[model samples]
Target: MGLKAFIGKLYAGIAQKQIENMRKNGIGLQNKTFQYLVNEATATVFGIDHGFANIKTYEDFKARVPIRDYEELRPYIDRIMRGDDDVLWPGQPAYLAKTSGTTSGVKYIPISKQSMPEHITAARNALLNYAYETGNTSALDGKMIFLQGSPEMHEVSNIPVGRLSGIVAHHVPIYLQGNRMPTYKTNCIEDWEEKVEAIVDETIKQDMRLISGIPPWCQMYFDRLSAKTGGKKIKDIFPNFKLFVYGGVNYEPYRARIEESIGFAIDTIETYPASEGFIAFQNSQKDKSLLLLVDAGMFYEFIPAEEFFNDKPTRISLKDVELNKNYALILNTSAGLWGYNLGDTIKFVSKNPYKILVTGRIKHYISAFGEHVIGEEVEHALMKIAAEEGLDVVEFTVAPQVNAPAGQLPYHEWFIEFGKAPADLKAFSQKVDKVLQIKNIYYADLIEGNILQPLIVKVLKKNAFVDYMRAEGKLGGQNKVPRLSNDRKIADQLTEYILN
Candidate 1:
């Protein structure tokens, strides 16, 4: 191994010890994190208002702070944006992570100096853990590309503000700077298509071994590269490519098409990161679920997904969580977000090491006919059937077709963009419907009761989803189409791209 690789291995060994300690003492670490955050922010405006000074227990904290989403927390954030001192964190925020919100037009999440290192360290540790377990560090020697938002930042009240990925770009460890690709000039281009074209031109000849990005954007890059090379496989173009790091959305639905683009299967590392904080990462290749970061300067709370909207939903710490039960994730971070409803639902696959799988979004689900189906169920069903039928799906979404033609029953409409169309569309649809039924019993009951018909498959033209996202002004960089929706907002817009 090279000197850099040897150093990386040694660092990985040290990180492994820390990880083992975290696994062994997750509960105690979480409690300490809670106390640290509470004590650190006790003098802040939010903390003072919430009585953090006298709060001595989790229940006290819970009773003092109400769970809030971005809209509800915006008042405190606005104060900080106006240059107020000790409003959220101890002082002013180090940076603001700008992200698109559903109801709120734009959200600016704080990232304190104290909390920012956790994000960087968790991501670094994820990679180091991979090297430690697999004994592979060859990718570090080759060009590594992280397809992300622009690194350019503008300041608000003298505080740097930019996309989470963009902010992270400015902090890339100096050691890896030599290996990172896609010149700063190319990265700074605002238009995604132009940026991608520039990236293709810049990296096509480089020895790319580690590529990281959201799956859809990466797929676009692969497609662009294929077009440029006259249909060359990704592996053929970058023969040394070894690991793909992806987050922001579930990769299962895009797995087949992505592998086909690459010409073979490759190792992958999945991470769970957000504007609020870095939550978890896949520490082991054998375990698909992410290892929750208990010591990452954030305290976690869970509310049963089914009871999330209740006036008094049961909120429990990690110690009280049960296996396989879906919970809406809540966060109280060193960044000074208190009782923040993260809006994502997760299921604990293992409690010993605190491993979790992000099941879906709390607000993103299909229940038009009283059959609530989530993102995981839909993705699981489609991925299962696609594998069995040897089909390759590029992208897909599920929505209720509540208003069917006069004689037709209301049904679930599956808008699918297929890389490889199935031999029998009807059989494919039936198989997916069956699997979905098995996954969500409520849907099965609805179908059995004749309340809803079997799902209808609508094959979309090539690049349909890409076109839709572009039209919606959400082309790339952490933007993704919802997998399931109870209403027809997305379905209505998608009609324009439906195959005739």
Candidate 2:
């Protein structure tokens, strides 16, 4: 919060303003603003440096400084370690948000008061902008709840990586010096065993409404709320809770259970927040997935899956982005990431510059046994099969344990917990296997020859994943379920006890 940092943030705000101005240009960028943006882009392209301070043209930036990844800034992190202004951006960053990438590995994303507004701005655009344009803010009246990570800033860890919890912690309304809860903060449970109890306790204490967070966690919470309140349904406890905002992972399968638990189909809003950026959120009631917050504080770029590997990889600017096209998201935020691959793919559903859809995870792709599968495909198949079985399913995760040779079973261990188990297991398994085959062609071939084994649904004990996360110190706050696995390893380890 020093003057130098203030100046840095001032510059960032100005830079952010210039970028947003480009969006209003419509079809394409106007020449003046475009040139100005390119100039700003060149100087802060990889963060401000006196070494390249004089550079003024986009072509000069391209010719001199090539596109780089997060690792290339090792020297910058070293400078940050010394409290020097070697890192990108103008200010000295204050805190780091410890967050994990799509991969299990973790990184501490750099955050400063200046750069934090990007999150605030994106969130405002998500709510205020939509409300102003469409008169939808009225839905958020009464107590608003955000199912985000705890605001306890970790004292250690200097590596700067972006994650949702830290970002959520950074921007949430704070009226207290202690824990970071929403305005109507009450006695919340920090204990794993007592976490759901605490949520139930708080819900009953206040006229609670307006819920937000990942689907699995939110669903589990209200289910516990319904149970603890004796007969008070979630609809009653949260009568004013008009919108149930969800993000963090693919939510198709869990939506039905959430609606069922609440005993009513409440408003469901979707968002996509990551360590890299608050990529997109539900603008209108019509949900196609992530609607890109184009007017955010960053330069947006997209590279298709096929061209993502070229030496001189090509990218599509915001104005040039095509509809119905799937491309990897690359972000250049004021916090200092330039040309950074966010490890997620988005399909542009409409030409609305501010709206787009999250198709799938670029890193969540599981091909452990040559059966290429994405989260959505697996999710749809499971939902369909579960529907056929007539069971209320809570949460499920898929992991491929083995690489099968042709005609051998490629084990797909599914951990599923249901409100009520289906009367018949054989029929349920057959339906699940068929769902797999119809969804993924490679898996279908694998199943036909027994390369991938018949589906196995291990009905978990209720609130099992929640208990596990609480045990890991990751429950209640901004923690997320292990959505899709890169391999079968984590899914196996987490569910090993209950599976047997």
Candidate 3:
């Protein structure tokens, strides 16, 4: 191994030991984290207002603070933006992670000095754990590319503000700076297509062994590279390419096309990260679920997903979670967010070490007919059929079609973009519908009761989703198309791209 690889291996060893300790003491560490956050923020305006000083246990904390989304917390966030010190967190925030919100338009999530390092550490340890488990650190010696938002930032009350991925770009460890690709100038381009073109120009000939990005954007990069190289596979361009690290969405739907572009299969690590906090990461290659980051300066809570919208939902801690049940994730972070609803749903796959699978978004689902189909269930059903039929799905979405033509029953409409269309499209649709029914019993009952028809598959012309996102001005950088929607807002717009 090279000097850099050897150093990485040593660091991985130390990180692995720390992770083992965390696994063994998951519940204890979470309790400690909870106490530390509550105690540290006692003097802050939000803390004082919520009676944080009197909170001695989880129940006490819950009673003192009610669950809040970004909109509800905006009043406190406004104070911070207006130059208030010790408002939400201790003193002023080091940075504000700017992100798009569905209902709120834009959100500025604070990243405190004490909390920022946890994000970087959790990301670093994910790779370190991968290296330690696989005994492969050679990727550290090669060029790496992280396709992310522009690192440019404006100031709000003297705090640097930018997208979470862009803010993270500024913190790439000094040691890895030399190995990072696509010069800073290329990364700052505002237009995603133009930025991707510049990236291709800069790194097409370089040795790119580690590539990281959301799966859809990464697929676009692969397509651009192939065009630049006259249809050459990604492995042909970067022969040393080995590890792909990704998050933000499920990768299974895009797996076939990505591997085909790469010319072969490669090791991948999945991470569950967000602007609020780094939540989990895949610790072992053999395990598909991610190990929850219980000790990473954040305390977690969960509400049963079915009861999430109730007037008074049951909120439980890590010790109370059971395997295979979906729950809406909540957190109290060192970043000064208390009783914050993350809006993501997750299911515990392994409780011994507290591993989880991100199931879906709380607001992103289809239940127009009382058949609540989630992102995980749709992805699972689609990918299963795609694998069996040797089909390549580029992108897809599901929405309820409440109104149909005369004498037709209401049904789920699937908008699918295929890299390679199936030989028998009708048969393929039936197979997917059968699988989905098996996965979601509610959908099956709706069909068997004659309340709905088997799903209708609508083929989408190539680049349909890409075009839809572009039209909506959300083409790249952490933005993703929702897998399922209950209404026809998105479905109505998608009609223009449907194949005749």
Candidate 4:
């Protein structure tokens, strides 16, 4: 009937067969899925061997195809670098999904009409799976605001071209096609700016609830709804609104701010949103990975952080992925990708098949001398400081730069933007540094060698991340700011323009 019913039925149908496949193969369920995917991946690239065809058999793929990062995807990047339809796989790449990654300067990801369904299905199934778990399927009543990239519609064709928003723009035509979607689909127009504005307008009028997108965009949507309707809080704008779904970026300060702004402790759900795929999600209970969409789309991989990019990356099969272990996330998607390292570190919050926590980005790590620093480490450090300082951090970024003098270990430099800064800010910084140093003996050794020093706090002014993003045009409506930077190039530029 609805999206959920259709997906639920689909999920149920495959689940039983999946169990049987696992039993027959004498392998774990997760591996069974991956094995099946290997079969498909080998098929997708079986005969072809160029940007037009990178497909090789599973064994050949394993031997010939090295695991590639965003930078390694350069050839494919170059093919569609110009957004030439001819370069993409035998179809129109609905829009080029833009993301500012580690190495490759501003690159556009080719998201096709076919790829769109996988993303949509994985995301939709995640929500329904959550609903089944929480017994709150009806909680989706009222308006559901999506805080995605602004629909940057092409003026001539009346479609969208915004890099990040392309993720949704392609779907607009399909969902809104005559009888395919509910009447609500027509609420979206053919204008870039109006896409977000129209969604806002509907929530105010239709009592919207269930907002989804990155944390920053959600806050913007609320700000727009509040400023326009004279209602400062999300509840004030949509009184019937019940749930707020967030992902794409971490939700620390926004969580506190939104909770305070909303009259009641509103429903807040977090998800793992990526351009290549929607990999994992969190539900209302916040018990970590809710339910993984194992059947519908992609085959995943997990390599240990210690060896993710090494000559021989230490890896564990999905079947071997344990609960609460940080592993580099890799995937082979139905959209024609094999052994793709998505460049994010995730932990198995559960092992009942498909579920994980988005710990941090694989590339965004701070190795204080030797103790490898990951996003989770920084998140822990900041959350601890926030709790101690009684501050609600809206957004923050960390940069492990060559900030120290020529020979000293580089400092764990943090640029913090908080809802409240304490009088004893120095104490806060000291505490954070102390925690990190103790947590990793590498920090202690580095401190002994003056290789690593204490955590330095750069208290940013308001809307610091936003200003930095704006300076970089990273704020073009539906984009996000990097949560962590290894160098001061992007980070300092952002801090100078915004936080300074």
Those runs of model 4 whose alpha carbons end farther than 4 Å from true positions after fitting are 1-60, 76-98, 108-114, 138-141, 152-202, 227-231, 283-286, 401-410, 476-478, 494-500
Kindly list the per-residue Cα lDDT of model 2 for residues 1-500, writing each as its tens digit: 43432343444444445434534553344234334334443444243453345545444444554555555655565466566553565555656666654443555566655557767666645554344434444343345666655444434344343335644655554421122234323323345336555555655666555677777777767767777778566877767656677777776777777777787877666777665566667756655555565544556677885466678766666667788666878776656665567777777776644567676666666677667677667777777877766677777777776755666666776777676677886678778778767877888887777666776667778767766676666775556665467676657556654734
Q: What are the Cα lDDT values of the candidates?
A: 0.93, 0.61, 0.93, 0.61
* TM-score, one value per model: 0.99, 0.79, 0.99, 0.79
Give residue 54's lDDT in candidate 2 (0 to 100).
52
**Alpha carbon deviation, residue 224, candidate 3 (Å):** 0.9
lDDT of 3 by residue, 237-344 (tens): 999999999999999999999999999988999999999999999999998899999988899999999999999999999999999999999989989988899999
Candidate 1 TM-score, C-alpha based: 0.99
TM-score ranking from best to worst? 3, 1, 4, 2
Tell me how far candidate 1 lies from the true structure as C-alpha RMSD in angstroms.
0.9
Q: Write the per-residue lDDT of candidate 4 for residues 240-314, one digit (tens) a residue.
A: 667677776667646766676666787667766577766656643656454555554566767887777689876
Q: Report the candidate with higher TM-score, 1 versus 4.
A: 1
Q: What's the number of clashes in each of the models? A: 0, 18, 0, 12
Candidate 2 weakest lDDT stretch, 10 residues: 175-184
lDDT for position 457 in model 4: 86
Against the correct fold, how does model 3 do in TM-score?
Answer: 0.99
Q: For residue 83, what is the lDDT in candidate 4?
A: 43
Clashing pairs in 1: none
Note the residue pairs that clash in candidate 3.
none
